[model samples]
Target: MTAPLHWKLVIDTTDAQTLADFWAAALGYEVEDQSRLIAQLLSSGDLPEAAVTEHDGRRAFRGLAAVRHPEDPYDAFTGIGAGRRLLFQDVPEPKTVKNRLHIDVHAEPDGRDDLVARLETLGATRLREVNQGPAGHWWVMLDPEGNEFCVA
Candidate 1:
């Protein structure tokens, strides 16, 4: 039998850094810090100045940014996380339809509204509330790029 596998949720976005920032805040995750590696690349002439970008007022990797659980083990040199992560990669076009796979944000009932409000402030738009009788209800929302998610 095969063992369990580990994976990350990869998202395509036009502005990777921005999306990373939002999701990081929403999930209380840490942005993977790769400045050290980038600096080495720059000094070794393996990377150009144009390969870096300013994000959240700090130097960050260009074209892609990722956020990981704060407590996750990671490779300090490469900034690769070993736990839950969301990697935002650059794409040419925007999202045009509902996501076939969507994440459901689950929080304590007392904190659900606050969490939803916080997500809204971070660029998520509330689509509508869904109540499934006994199974419970959730709020359908769209991310900054229009991908669907639920806050419950």
Candidate 2:
């Protein structure tokens, strides 16, 4: 028998909190809070002081933040998530090249042009317009943090 898949996408970021906020606003998801994990790590002294940080005046784990689909299942206390989600994990370096794998959003009603406008308002900028003869039209757009996605 074929195996059932289990998955979520993780994106690397220098600032997890900021990236989480940006992605949540853009995708209409809520940020996952991992305060308990932070607390446990801090109290046990397993985490170094340098690995914890204050962002906007609140203590946060320096490495990660996540956003999940509103209707999707998540553990109430820890926010371990299931369903459409993007996890942003902090890294010291910046993203240096184009994404090898990216998302393509299909337009529901009036089509690609209309979807492009909505995405623009959400801080995605158009990269290029591609016309696929019989297949359809698409726009290559970049998210606020420069990750690419297609509107088609």
Candidate 3:
């Protein structure tokens, strides 16, 4: 039998909440909140008080947050599985180099340039422009965090 295919992508970040917020707003997705589980555990005495951590002047459950396409399916209770999703996991160190894999977004006919401009307004910077064989063109850009993505 073939294994089930999963459709989620993950990124490492020093601040998962910040990344979650940026991506949620940029992609029109909602941030996943696991605090309900954390709170339930705390109230049921199943989790230690130390399990929760403060982040960015807000209380975070510690470790992970994600954003997903609004129309994509995901479990509301667990916020797990089945979506075009971006997950940000907390790490002690910051990203120091270019990403080996990144995302590219395609826009509607005649809408790419406008999309690029809008993205720039949102803190993405154009890195370069390229024109290839037979009328193909694209712009390489970097996100606020320096991750690269192409607009075409």
Candidate 4:
């Protein structure tokens, strides 16, 4: 039999912390708080001082940041989520092509518009309206880095 597997959705970004912050607010998730480990590593030279940076006045890994479902169980040592998570890792290339896979955020029937508006205020851009006839409708939007997602 196959062993159990778990995963997180990871995206390449120019600024990991900012993207993590945007998604944390947009999804109502919390930024993974890994400062304690970072401080320990920095002090012991396990991690170089340059390997960490500050975001929102808190220390964070320089190239990566993540958000986790608020209610998800997480490792206190690494501050990593055991359930749903989204990780942003820094990359040099810009996003030039459309996404072949994307995230769709579902909400209460009456909450779509308000949620879309809220995301826009967080730096998401409206792409277009997708109407699927009898299936339903959803708003396609781009994140601050131009990554596409849907509010349905």
Q: Scored by CA lDDT, what does every candidate get?
A: 0.88, 0.81, 0.78, 0.94
Candidate 4 overall lDDT versus native: 0.94
Q: For residues 4-103, could you state the per-residue lDDT of candidate 2 as single tens digits?
A: 7868898987778887887787667888776767777788998887887776556677777889999999887667687888888877888789999987
lDDT of 4 by residue, 24-104 (tens): 998899999999999999888899988999998889999899999999999998898999999999998999999988999
Answer with 1 or 4, whichever has the higher lDDT: 4
- Residue 102 of model 3, lDDT score: 86
Off by over 4 Å in 3: 1-3, 46-59, 133-135
Ranking by TM-score: 4, 1, 2, 3
Q: List RMSD in Å for every model shown.
A: 1.4, 2.4, 2.7, 1.2
Candidate 2 residue pairs that clash:
none
lDDT of 2: 0.81
lDDT value for model 3: 0.78
Deviation in angstroms for 33 in model 4?
Answer: 1.0
Reference-based TM-score of each model: 0.92, 0.81, 0.80, 0.95
Tens digit per residue, CA lDDT, model 1, 6-92: 999999889999888888888899889888888888899999999899876767778899999999899989898999999999888
Which structure among the candidates has the greatest TM-score?
Answer: 4
Return the clash pairs for model 4, or none: none
- The predicted structure with the larger lDDT, 1 or 3, is 1
Rank ordering of all candidates by lDDT, starting from the highest: 4, 1, 2, 3
Of 2 and 3, the candidate ranking higher by lDDT = 2
Point out the higher-scoring one by lDDT: 3 or 4. Answer: 4
Which sections of candidate 2 miss by over 4 Å?
54-58
